[model samples]
Target: MTEQTSLWQDETQSADFAELCSALYEREIAQLANADIQSPQVIQGRLKSLPYYIKRTAHLMLQTQTPLDLDVQNASWSAKQAAHMPLSGQEIAEVNKWYLAQTLTHGLVVPVATTTHIVLDSIDRIDQQNHRFRTNVHGWFYLNDTEQKDKKVNANYRLLKPNKRVMTAACTGHCWVNDHKTNPVIPSLRELLLSCAINWRNFKQPVIF
Candidate 1:
């Protein structure tokens, strides 16, 4: 008796998935080519100029409305046994989608621009009478631009300590919090794009800028 082949072992489906990935990659590269990060207008628009190919791909998946049966534990076990018992095509696709979402949401990081400035909200201040005040005034503490190595510099133009209490710069044109306790890091353009893509994918809807 001949053994029946599993859907996961079908070469056609695997080829199709590879083609889909290639097409998406090409589309993303094309969109990125058109975006000039150094342009003042692009920076002013924040991450609006960047293309969200991941979200767009997710939207296409939503159109299929395919119910996914993703068992995390089972998936992990299947991955471990992949060389012996392979997962189905659907399972592979679901795993890839989940991984893509995870990567876009958390794993990716980009370099900060050298010209970017770190503006902090001054919480403590000194009065005109030489008396230091604990007033939680919402003042601005503009730090110098990052050094050649992307290190944060203080008002004295020195490397800032990690535990220093200061308002750190956020994405351009985005509102920042004045929390005096935790140090904030600026979000890169790719980070912003990834966030938007992830949110759109989760909501299964278009995100308006």
Candidate 2:
């Protein structure tokens, strides 16, 4: 194993992992906010509010993971679904961080040109009408253990409260064979964040039920 791999394995149960997650989150958020900001003032405000956004994202993830009266906002059909997940609480924290990082990164750019257009349009609308334009990332993950050997993980991201929670953008997701221990696909926090933002848009509009 390489030195970096050894370090990753060693830090799986260490504070270093948590710190790495935090750092990665900050970097990802900064990149997203910088890329989408409408003005310098907006960028300044986003930078100032970074901690709040990060904290809110972390809290939401924690809340979703916790069972409330045996109900989770996002849950797999069986505990077996999470079998591939580590049982360690500390490690779970790191995993959650990783998930959130990827989710946020992907959430911002899933719809490609549409995402940017929407953000810019919202900014224009806000400036023109002095109204609030809210957009957020929401999605779920399911562990795939089908007969097929590949695509062991599935995740999607959609616009939150697409229409006052009465409607939402259709989810866009992809499958991956995640085996970080060997031939790690996400070797570093940078890669983890970078992977979240794809060069292409792979999404469809929300379908109202």
Candidate 3:
């Protein structure tokens, strides 16, 4: 007797995923009331420089056509953008289309002892290293893409890893990944990125939010 494999392996699972992602995006947007925590409209108004600002801040812009948040980058992209060159919307959509169309299970939990966390509208990434295990932890909180060319694409990225250690002081253009020769050399490197989107209802009137 032949047994059937998972639908994801059959392609239907991936198709379902695209639909699921679209639905999730909508659910996030639909909950946006002016009084809601994650109001889409309020987020759009608070737009600022893209990329870094997008990462360190809890700002998420609402889109009219699609459920995706606005592709945000600074008025100017940081050096990383010029070197690595982040993704654009069309590119992302294409990826999402492929990803959502697939069925795969990634990291899962089995109810072991886990760290507790709080939700902060403003978050910070600090680099701490020791002889044993070096970690960039997203404490109290932990947690996308967008387009344009005039500046670097409105990439939403975080301090994936600590940049200070990478030290761009003597580099070609103050770029960590690209400039520093020593940066190219590292041991057991683990880079993690995190972001947060504030509930508009919480800090609506504030200039910062």
The most accurate candidate by TM-score is: 2
Q: Which lDDT value does model 3 have at 206?
A: 18
* Candidate 3 regions with alpha-carbon error over 4 angstroms: 1-10, 34-41, 45-209
Model 2, range 1-209, lDDT digits (tens) per residue?
Answer: 69999898666534433453475465556566558566888777866875665544333333322211211122110111121212233232343333233323212322211221111001111111211222222222211223113523222222221211011111111112341212111112222222223222221221111
**Lowest lDDT block of 10, candidate 2:** 116-125
Clashes of each: 0, 1, 9
* C-alpha RMSD between model 1 and the true structure: 20.6
Off by over 4 Å in 1: 1-4, 7-9, 39-209
Per-model root-mean-square deviation over C-alphas? 20.6, 18.5, 22.4
Q: Higher TM-score: candidate 1 or 3? A: 1
Better of 2 and 3 by TM-score: 2
Give each model's whole-structure lDDT.
0.29, 0.28, 0.24
Candidate 2: the clashing residue pairs are 170-206
What TM-score fits each model? 0.22, 0.26, 0.19
Instruction: Give the least accurate 10-residue stretch of model 1, judged by summed lDDT.
Output: 76-85
Clashing pairs in 1: none
How do the candidates rank by TM-score, highest first? 2, 1, 3
